[model samples]
Target: MKKKLISLILTLIQLSVDFSIVAASISLVIVIILVASTPFTGFAHELFDYHSWWSLVLQAVTASVLVFLAIIMFVGVHSLLRNINSGLYFVNQNLVAVRQILWPSLVVFVLQSLASICFRL
Candidate 1:
């Protein structure tokens, strides 16, 4: 029963990870489109209160970096999940995958905190 329950939980996690990957991909595309169109549309100014082209550029770069990191993190999580599902729970590859996810997540956290500070100022 415990094995079955664990399997069910892992299956649910895999599904969640798959959905997150798709969502993150879509978000990346949308960020790219919005950044590409911002100069011409002046939407960033209205929406984000961007004061200048430099601010918009900074926002665009930050957003792109964040999204890219998120994608990397998700990919790492998928890999880790794959390893777990395969019954390779304590493998080196899983450690590497965890490290991959960890670095990106930490970077994302730092970047977000910095962004919040900058915006608030």
Candidate 2:
């Protein structure tokens, strides 16, 4: 029963990850389109005001990068979950995969926080 329950939970997680992949892809595409059309149209100016055009461009680019990272992270999670569901949870590759999922995001978080602080200053 415990195994079945775990499998069910993993299945739910898989579904959630799949949904996130779709959502992230859509967000990336939208951000790219907005950035691309920024100079051609008045959309960015209207949205961010004329004085903050550079900030708007920076934000849009940053959002696109984050969304791309999220998609990669989701794919990595799906791969890890697939292995775990198949009873390979304790293997060396899984350990490496877990670290791969964790450490980079931690670094990104730290860097992003520092960048925000510097920008504020």
Candidate 3:
């Protein structure tokens, strides 16, 4: 019964991770679309109050980086969960997936810090 319970929990986690992966992929597509259409549609100006081209560029770059990181994080999490579900929890592939998730999280933290400093300046 305990093994069955653990399998059920892992299955639930896998489902949630799959949903998150889909969400992240959709976000990536949306960010790409927004970045590409900003100049033509003036959507950033209207929605974000970005007055200058530089600000728009900065926003686009930041959004793209963030979306990419989110994708990486979600994908890594999905891989890790898949490994766990497959009874390979202590394998090297799982380690690589964990590193993939960790590095992206650290990058996001650094990116946020830099953005804060840039804004203050």
Query: How far off is residue 32 in model 1, in Å?
Result: 0.7
Model 2 RMSD, rounded to 1 decimal = 2.5
**What would the C-alpha RMSD of candidate 1 be, to one decimal place?**
1.5
Model 2 per-residue lDDT tens digits across residues 63-88: 67777777877877888898899999
TM-scores of all candidate predictions against the true structure: 0.89, 0.80, 0.88
Number of backbone-clashing residue pairs for each candidate, in the order shown: 0, 0, 0
Question: In candidate 3, which residue pairs clash?
Answer: none
Which residue runs does candidate 2 get wrong by more than 4 Å? 45-51, 118-121
Clashing residue pairs found in predicted model 2? none
lDDT score, candidate 1, position 83: 88
Q: Order the candidates by TM-score, highest first — what do you get?
A: 1, 3, 2
- lDDT digits (tens) for residues 29-79 of candidate 3: 888888888878866667544747777767777878998998899889889
Model 3 TM-score, all chains together = 0.88
Best by TM-score: 1
User: Residue 89 deviation, candidate 2, in Å?
Assistant: 1.3
Which is the winner by TM-score between candidate 1 and candidate 2? 1
True-structure lDDT of candidate 3 = 0.84
